[model samples]
Target: MAASPAKKRILVGQSGGPTAAINSSLAGVVAGAREAGAETVGMRYGIQGYLAGRTVALGEALPDDDALALLRRTPSSWLGSCRFKLPALDAPEAEGFFADAFAKLEADGFDAVLYIGGNDSMDTIAKLGAWGARMGSPIRFIGVPKTIDDDLVGIDHTPGYGSAARFVATAVSEVARDADVYDLKSVTFVEIMGRDAGWLAGSACLAGPDLVLLPEVTLDEDALIERISVLLEHQNTVVVAMSEGVRGADGHLIAEKTVAAGTGVDEFGHLAQLSGPSRYLAGVAKARLGVKTRAVELSTLQRCASHCASEVDLDEAFELGRRGVSAALAGESVRMCTLTRTGDEPYAAEYGTVDVLEVANKVKPVPREWICADGMGVTDDFRRYVAPLAGTLPQQLKGL
Candidate 1:
């Protein structure tokens, strides 16, 4: 379908959490829009910014050469970001708010909008697209994927997850090497990201099969302590990687146990949740068995280290952004730009569109069958599923 002949104008925004490869997607939007003769503008700080009338001309904010170069090197959301969840379309105020927003967009001459974000962000696109269609607004809405959580459904893996996983594998390997140097009896527990899914934690398996721990596996704390105890007994140094979301058979986050004991809450009305299993589990190891323990939390750095991005991930992110523009121009609405794996041996991906409703707010978890029965590691099948997504090793140093 060809886009209407009216002069092309676009608005792009970044929403949700920041990621290492987010800028690549942003760059893709700008460059592709330009090549397609669309005048592009950026909504500062996502939809919240757009609602508040904060924006900048993309050409003026980021000149062509600079934007393209920055896209490949930049980490985090370059246009800023927001976590605001729009009211559901059925809500009484929804219609009026969207009507006002779309009116503002039309007044500003924007015929298309691209939102770069994860799950919740996609939902925003879906709602706006639907509303635009119903009200006969000419604006087209598209979603560009970005998330370290890798939980977005209908996409093989979110862009930032690969870079974050690379960081995890690198950090764990370095920590393991450091622990090995200390002959004194000690246990080092490293916690990794994976709020609900074990993708990031599972990436530690790339460092080595021996150091892997995943959230999908229900842990045996007693057995874990015993295994560490045995390893300490012989080597005097032990290192283990655990997911922050890991749970024991009783169904409690190790961090939750610590918070319950009075670590208290933050301003967000939530407990000061740490990113890794290390701190809580380390306390358990020391108090119950008297072993000297240390915990390392690999938190935000995992998502902000563009210096360590996988080339494949970066390229795919940019391509997704470009395809998003093309799709929107062709009258595709309520769709998320996605990459589907076509092969694993010699990794290949094909760009496509998936209904935003299929992905919005839904999580894709690591398969239970991919986890080992003992609940401490991933099976070979898991390796096959993820290894292809990680793609071939890059020439850049790992874990930058």
Candidate 2:
């Protein structure tokens, strides 16, 4: 007779930044693992905690449908999150670190691991898989994408992006109306979040900003002032949307001048980008352009605004989680679950997998073609590309 397929113990964790739909993905992983006849453990605060031997008995913590349902709607990282970057398996310290981590997993009877996060989380997966192979361990690792920045590679778009984009669209439109409340010609600068990619900031285009600056292109301050001045001559209010990481022609962050000193770097070696470009521009417009100016920082509100979450985004997030777990249980490792867009007209996405190494530490920026020639607005093609994902653009205020 053929040997029986091996039973497995699966562990899941959340890492990096959280989003409105991240918990939905966790719930999906839990439910899918249970259905696959696998024992499940929740690594509290992700792999960082996993190494420290922190974990929760998921079956005991979220035992039923009601608990899982509540988890899906709850915003932020359900089990918690971390930004810890693992060193390569070939590093001098690797053997000692992997020994402890592998010992913990073995003691806990975990044979499969699922990491839900964006870029850095994938890096963890890739490194763990390398360690597993080197040690001849049977443990498998998989990555699930999650980020409001939408910079994760090997996917059409990420789970948290659509909902965050929806929030950006509505919030910008609402702010635009708020800025129009005065008789004086005013310039409003709306600051958006995107450390290395401009997808999140670009979503504000749907809200009708006179200027939409992406991180892909360096900011032209003179051009920006010139544009705003021209807009103010004809319009009472002009709103501009820009990314946090927008650089100058000299390849320096505009935030470098305005963000206070002593901001430290994260584990990923990226400067902990502070919020100040909008305020800086507001001051500049006041001094140079001679217009009333204001700045609005979207901040963490963008990622955790679950009330404004998109049903489409939540659904996809859940599906991706299930698919990632399913792939792992079927004996895949070092792979990331991805959503491949098969058709644009019908707007469909199919589940697929890409090597985690290809995705780890990689950033996907907005396509240059999607950005307009003038670099101030996005093209009609861009609208169609993200339209299905971004639901219910804020409507104009009705009636006087």
Candidate 3:
């Protein structure tokens, strides 16, 4: 009797930053691969570790249903992560790097390599897929999108965004109430993450922040101060949700002063230090408006708050992971799994694939029409588009 085809083997890795639902995707990959009668291996720290021969067998690391269930709710990258950028397919350095990486994959009989990450990570998949094609290799490369930034193109929204949006909305809502409790005039500035896109900062609209500042709209410092001064006159507390990436009319980051001295850019050339936007705004508000000012930077908490994760986000994230395995098994390559929004009435989404090359190194900015004419708030259309994915916030008690 002819021997059955050998079990398919695939390697997976996580890269870029971690998110609350990133592991849910990892769990789905592991569970799906096992159920498909395939062997699964994980990179300890994404491609960086894989290049160094650091890997773990998923069958041994996660043995059963219980492990996967727990992983779905686990916050952060389960297999560690990295931000290593790969050399261009045509670059001289690429000759050796690709040769070594492909040699390793071929030696281990890997049918595919799946990467879970954001824009930068997708770029890696694009390069690998291109290299494999050039060398006539059979191994496939796939990207399962994950990012709180929600900046990736070709997808309705990314997996980690919903959970992070949930956290931002919940935290801002709670903080708004706390800021108002003292019966004193105050301005609370909340700084949220978003380097080139303001999707995360725009989420603050779900919590009813008085003002929302986004990177898409340049900040007019004088106008902002005047607005806050006006807001303080009418309310006990004025809460503003600001994106750390917001820039001035001169096209420079308002939080530039906060960047640590001598901290260079990353492999992707993104600034390494991104904080203090809220503090700078708060100080300005306090000095100009003469009101109590408080600055709160959500920092890493937004991406790591598993307890605040949205069920919609986690479910979709996991399914996308499984989809990656199926795609690889089907001989698909250089593709990134995507979520297409099918309906808005009750909120629905369907999984699909887009060329990784189309998605890599791309940023999807919040639509201009979604922002208010004054650029201080989001429109009803924006709310409708994001509300379902982020889930509903709990009703809070109102003090009479």
Candidate 4:
């Protein structure tokens, strides 16, 4: 009897929180996998879904042109998402989980897997790939980067961060312009998202040299009040940018401690709540600084504003996904697709693969050198790092 042809199957999943460019990465992965003669499959939700034996054909799930186009423009994860943290490889349950998952993949004829997500998601890829290699399972795994936090190490910046930063800077600049025109005695505090790192808030510094407040600086609350008082006394309007992760002298998240604890909890037992630092600061300004205050939480808008996405970020994200597929086809396993800055002048990126273990679950903080001494702004170097990511400036709009 003649030998049978080997099954060629590829599995792709979204593993972390969504971003504006996540779907672009997905599109690239789908297009590349199909071109490489592999039957592409999508794991519903994420690794958890794989463990539970839930999956669908990529062609059926994503459909054709119009749906794929919508996927490209959609902000959040279209396949849905979860924050299930995989247990450490050394844990007792880890081996059993891997055995069962790989058995399922092998039975289902999956030869490769690609996970699109941020640091933690890459960790999942590393774990599964390493286990598969050790077990001699013929499955290759690749990781595609995605995060608005911009904290993933080794890469120049995560895909979603550029678009989010662009949105933040634009909104902050517009708020500043609005404040400049108003004669009403009020203080506006704009709060941005950044869990532990301050990348999102730091981007607000790009609005202008003097318009941002960063967590990197140990801010004096009294001094801030005085400054706002002075601004309101003289100009009748003041706009301030703040990070949700801003820490006090004790190093606690100002917003985390102040926000009202939500009654809800997810599967991870993490609190489901919004940061309250901006609202808290607004109250303080109104009470102590004797100025009317307004708070604007630029929460989900930062991550989901596909309409305001940075073209550079989108292109890079898609390229990263294609490269990830290529690397997997080349037999690269336990690796993440990375884009490193080759030059700052013309904004060049060199795509390559790095050990996912090296980049997984570890955060890269905003450089101290990039923070201004007063702790209220970023230096020119920080701006240089982010400016090119925004691509060309948008045309200015005139009142009709």
Q: TM-scores, in order shown?
A: 0.91, 0.96, 0.98, 0.92
Ranking by TM-score: 3, 2, 4, 1
lDDT of 3 by residue, 1-400 (tens): 9999999998999998999999999998998898799999999999999989999999998999999999999999999999999998778898999999999999988999999999999999999999999999999999999999999999999999999999999999889988988989999999999999999999888888999999998888899899888877788899999999999888898878677689788899988888888888888889988889999999999998988899999999999999999999988999999999989989998898999999998899999999988778889988888789889776662223
Candidate 4 total steric clashes:
0
List, in order, the clash count of every candidate structure.
Answer: 1, 0, 0, 0
The better candidate by lDDT, 3 or 4, is 3
Worst 10 residues of 1 by lDDT: 267-276
The collision pairs in model 1 are 191-276
lDDT tens per residue, model 2, 103-184 = 9888888888999999989999999987898888888899999999999889999999999998898888889889998898
Selected candidate, larger TM-score, 3 vs 4: 3
Clashing residue pairs, backbone N/CA/C < 3 A, model 3: none
Q: Mind giving the per-residue lDDT tens digits that candidate 1 earns over 1-400?
A: 9877876998999987798888889888988888898888998999999889899888887786765877666888888998777777899999788889888988998878999998878988988888888899878888998898898999988988888877777777778777767557888888887767888888877766355667667778889888788776677777777788888778777667655455665432334565536787888889987878899888787888776678887888888888889998999888999988888778787899999988887889888888777777787876776665555554332544
Report, for every candidate in turn, its global Cα lDDT versus the true structure.
0.81, 0.88, 0.92, 0.80
Runs of candidate 2 with Cα error greater than 4 angstroms are: 1-7, 394-400
Alpha carbon deviation, residue 199, candidate 4 (Å): 1.3
Return the lDDT, model 3, position 132. 95
- Position 278, candidate 4: lDDT: 86
In candidate 4, position 15 carries an lDDT of: 72
- Highest-TM-score candidate: 3
Report lDDT (Cα) of residue 26, candidate 3.
Answer: 96
Among all windows of 10 consecutive residues in model 3, the one with the lowest summed lDDT is 391-400
TM-score-better candidate, 2 vs 3: 3
Q: Could you tell me the TM-score of candidate 1?
A: 0.91
